[model samples]
Every structure is written in structure tokens, then in C-alpha cells.
Target: MNRTLTERARSMRIHSGLPKQFWAEAVNTTSYLINRGPSVPLKHRIPEEVWIGKEVNLSWLKVFGCIAYVHIRVFKYKNGSNSVLVVKKDDYDKCNTEKPIMKMDDGDSVFKFDRSGPFFFISGNKDNSQKDQKLIVVVLAIRNHNKFPPVAVPPAPVGQTPASSPSPTKSSPSPAPATTPSPISHTTSATSLSPI
Candidate 1:
């Protein structure tokens, strides 16, 4: 067992970018995997199963140092989507919504989950109609696109600049006043409105 654990640790170290400081974690993880992982000499039954005389759950098996994506049970896993809307389990089931839900942990003011995956949440979700909604906290993972969003950048104006950029021999002209587009309002149209 000691030899196997060191061997696994050595393999992980070769493949992982983890530094020597995390060797302890690697060894511990390797030991855990060895005790739970299947062995050939034991006829494919893991050490834990052989000791306990029962099949053990291997669902938690993971690489010592690797990236993993978390599967959210209630969330929509649609095309190239990068966000999850966390809702209550009951509400999600009741509504038969495709939105994601999380299991509420017991006996704690806060619960933390080890993160994986590629979708991040935008700030702020509030419902004026729901009183207890403020207590809901959500964590989201965002897929990293190598590109960064432009800072403090807005849409360019529809037309060319009012003044041409200054030349060495010419004086620069002041920029023209910018026009702000009016917000479009949606009201009941004559055709859509119906008598109560």
C-alpha cells in the first residue's frame, strides 16, 4: 500500500502543475484512491470493499489534480450558455422549469461547494414580490474566453465623429454634442388590448 501510494503520487506529480508544497495533498489523495480503487490481485474489488465485504460507491473518484466540471441537476445545459439561475428545489420541480436548483445543506448559515466548470453568474438577482428571496445566495462559474471585455467601452456612435482629428498644421475642432437615444416604451397596443 505504501509503495502504491508513492507510485501514484509520483505519477500525479509528473502530470500536475502542483508544486512540492502540495505533496501532502497528493499523497493523501493517492492513499484514499488506493483504499477505494479496484485492485487486480483482489479480483477487481477495491480494498474498502474487500475489508467491508460490500460494494462501495466510487462516484467520488477524481484525479488528484485535474479540472472537473460540475453537473447541475436542475439547470439547463443549453448550447454555449455560460450562466445558471439557481432556484429552490421545490419551486423548480413544481414549475417543471429547466432552470438549475441546488441542495440546501443542513445546520449551517453558509455552505460552500468546491467549484468546477465554465459558467459564471452576473451580479444581482432580486425579486420584489418574493419576501424571502434575499436570503438566497448563488455561486456561478464562468467559462473563460481568452479575450477580455473592453473596459469602460460603450457602443460607437452611429455616424462619423463630428470633427476630424487635428492635423499638425490645423487646429482641432471641438467634438459635436453626443445624442442619447430614447428608451423605447412598451404599452398595450390597440390590437393587443382586450376588454376585461
Candidate 2:
């Protein structure tokens, strides 16, 4: 049946009065097939195999372009907790926008937004000292919360001993070195305590 239909289609190529409606339908089908091919390839393409290591996880799944909230630093002047801000993806489209605020869901914290806003993108987690930089910048959604509190800087690395005032000399002698006691052997019988 398909071969017969193909022969008829070939014969119809030479025929001049093939219905105008049929010609229009054929063109429409060809155009539709061409336009649909790219999207079909996208849907049918095999996803790259992802082998997660023991340390990596793939549990959380959120829709792209969905709203999310991120926590920001506490306000400097106000003595209160920081707030959550709404972040969206569309805000990070511009190139010149630096210091964009981004909201991250690292599983430990859940940010709640009071109002909807664009994500303020932050720089990626790459070390800035390296010469070949292809760092991914992260955009953060910062709420109107207070600016982050100053982090307590760690103390300087230990080197010098702290100076102490010299104590008066004492005449007491030093004690002898202590000796370890030998392990004692126990009998097989269990002991019970009696209450009065």
C-alpha cells in the first residue's frame, strides 16, 4: 500500500491540476516537519550520563524560573535577625550589572521572601587569585534586611608565647616521677548491691 501511494505521489508530480488545497497541505507539512525537527531533537537527545560521587546528591528538584528566597546579612544598625528576599532569574540577564545578589539553597537554610524581587548576583565560588579565570558569578536575591554583620575574624596565627610577670622564686622541691599501677585480676563472681 505504501509503495502504491509513493508511485501515485511520483505520478502526481508531473500532473498540473493536483488540487491547490493538496499542494498547500503538502507545503504546510514540509514546513511543519522542518520547524519541528530541532525541538524533537532536543526532546530525543540522550542526556549526558551523570555519575554522582559518594559526596554528591541529586534529591532536590525545583522548577526553573520559579521564585525563591535567600537570606542576607543582618542590618548593621538594627540589632535584629536578617530577612529573606525574593529572587528571580530574569534580573541577571544584563552584562554590566555587577555584584548581583543571588539566592542559594544549600539545604541548611530556607530563605523566605517578604516581597518579590530580582536576584542580586554574587560572584562564583572560584578563587580570585588564579590567572585563568572562568568563574561563574552567582546572583543573589537580597531582601531589604540589614547589611551583613561583621564576621568575627579569627585570631592571628600562634607564634609568640604570651608574656607573663615573673613570679618570686620558691624553695619547694620537685616531686618524683609517678609510676603506673599493674592491672588487678578479677574473680568470675558478679557482685550485687543491697538496699536498706
Candidate 3:
């Protein structure tokens, strides 16, 4: 047990960089874990479980010394938490845009919008398919009122704008494939230019 405690402390010093103030905690936690293991002298019963006469649930155990990526700090927009996904116009056409705000059922992102305007248009998750699919941007959703939702950004590598097929009525500079500008977020769910 002395050897084990010394080895654990050395390992923690080598990698964990935990302060010496927590050496007692390290020794205690290690002792508790060791006590939970099946002991040959105790007829293979875990020392900690022998008192309770129940099987110890080891599921809560984690790597003793490990590095975990809990979160990546960056620009808020780039973090992808509340990201505005920008996809190519060609890719945008594939969306079932009639309703884009999807409901997450059991962690599966399911399309649920009938008309439009539900609360959130969060990032897409895998439906039943095993393949990963690109998430649709929220800007394309048809708003319930006359006002437009957020702007649609084109999914081009940074510093470039994706150029759409030119309308004959207007001539616009083509954004290079390598350089795509943020596409206009406005997409109308226009029925007709009819008088109310």
C-alpha cells in the first residue's frame, strides 16, 4: 500500500500537476479505490462492499489521471453552440424548408415544423441514418410574420462568398469559389404578389 501510494503520488506529480495540499486526498481516494477491489485475504470480497453485503457498483469510476475536452473556448459564433450554419446554395436547396425547426426526440433530431416559426432552430443531429448529414441554417426558415428571420450565411471557407446563379434582370460580381461572401439571409416563402 505504501508503494502504491508513492507510485500514485509520483504519477500525479509527473502529469496531474495537482498541488501537494491535495496529497492526503489523493492517498484517501486511492485507498478507497483499493479497498473496493476484490481482496485475496478477504475471500475475494471487496473490502468496501463486505460491510454492506452488496455488489459494488463500479460504473461511477473514471480514469484516475486523464484529460478531457469538456468545452472549447473561442468566438461565440464559432463555438457552434448558437452557431449560424452557412451552407452552399446548392446544399440549401436540399433542405425540407417548409419546416426547418426540428424537435429532438430521444436525442434524435426529427423534422417537426408544419408551417414555420417554432421556438428554436438549433443545430441538426443525426436522424436514424448512420451517416453524418450537414445541418441546415435557421435563416432559411419562413417566418410566420411579414418580417424576415436572421440572415442566411453561405457555407464557404472563411474569407470567401458563395456566388448564386445570376438573375437575368441583374448583373452581380461572382464571388470566387475560393472566396465566398456571406449570402443574403433573405429567402422568401412567396406564394404570389397578390393584393390582400
Candidate 4:
């Protein structure tokens, strides 16, 4: 067991390109995987499942050493406006805040990151008059496309027909029914940062 753990940890560290300082973390992660993985002695049952008497959930597993972004949000008490931005990898590493990617004062909460790369965020508000403000920055390292597989969308049901509308009479024409757009689905990623 010791030899197997050491070998798996070494492989994980080398494959992830992590430094030797993370040896303890690699060993811990390897142990976690081994516990959740199927064991030959247990007849292909996961060790954790056998011990806990329940099925193990593997949906949250992710590859190590993936690119991640940091989320920074600031709340202004005087104007009741909120500023939010996602810090990319490069800017986050250099801790640069000279210029932000996007800045707005309309209190927009929408944040979108389509591509995987380094990004940084800074407050658009230059007004330093408001000393009564609260700032909360949570640095999160999420698995990017390079490190993890993309999620597959389920296929639509075959032979599905659109609902028929009532025939409009000549006397009074019925207006077209308003159609609502389908909700967008976002893939969940694993976070590498531990909570403070």
C-alpha cells in the first residue's frame, strides 16, 4: 500500500508539473483518489463505498494544475452600487491593478469569460471620497478547458413536434404567443484554492 501510494503520488506530481514543495498535497490527493477508486480485493467496489455502505459520487473530480481565475467584488455603501470583475491568471500573478478590463457604473452584475487565458480585474470607480465601502475578493483557481474535458450537451428528444396554435379568426386575429428563450447551461469546475 505504501509503495503504491508513493508511486501514484509521484506520477501525479510529475504529470501535473507541480513543484516538489507540493509533495504532501500530491500524496493527499493520491490517497483521496485511491480511497474512492475501485479496489481489486473489494471485487471492483470503491473502498470508500464499501466502508461507508453507499455509492461514491465522482462527478466533482477534475484534473490537477488547471488554469483558474479570481473573482473580485466590491460593494459601495454610499451609492448602493456593486462592482464585480474576474481576475485572469497573468494579472493575478503579477497583482496588477493599474487598468481594469471593463469598467461601468450602471451596477451591472453580468460577468462573462468565454476563453481560457490570464485576466485581471480592477475597480472602475475612481472616486475615493466614499470611505465607507466594503470589498470582498475571493481568489478561485478553477479547472480550465486545457486541464478538463468539456461537458457534453444532451441530445434533444427525437420526433418532438411543436405545439399547434389556435387558428386566428378573420373577425379578430390572435396575436403570436411570446416565446421564452431556453436557460443557458454552464459547466461546473473544481476549485483548487481552499477556503480561508
Query: Highest lDDT among the candidates is held by which one?
Result: 4
Specify the poorest-scoring 10-residue window by lDDT in model 4.
132-141
For residues 60-174, write the lDDT of model 2, one tens digit per residue: 6332223355544331221222222222344233322234354333323333334433233322322321222222323223222333354455665699665699677887866
Candidates 3 and 4 compared: the better one by TM-score is 4
Ranking by TM-score: 4, 1, 3, 2
Clashes within 3 Å, all models in order: 7, 16, 10, 4
Clashing pairs in 4: 88-119, 88-120, 89-118, 89-119
Q: How many residue pairs clash in model 2?
A: 16
Residues 31-54, model 3: lDDT tens digits = 777788888999998998888888
When sorted by lDDT, best at the front, the candidate numbers are 4, 1, 3, 2
TM-score of 4: 0.38
| True-structure lDDT of candidate 1 | 0.49
Task: Please tell me which model should have the higher lDDT, number 1 or number 4.
Answer: 4
Model 3 TM-score relative to the real fold:
0.30
- lDDT of prediction 4: 0.56
lDDT of model 3, residue 155: 85
Of the candidates numbered 2 and 3, which has the greater TM-score value?
3
Best by TM-score: 4
Residue 102's lDDT within candidate 1 is 42
- Model 1 lDDT tens row, 1-196: 6666766776675456454545566677788777887789999878998898998988877555565454443323333322334455454323322444542223222234455322222212223113232233222333233333544546668886566785676667679999865444335554332111
Flag the better candidate by TM-score, 1 or 2.
1
Give the winner by lDDT: 2 or 4: 4
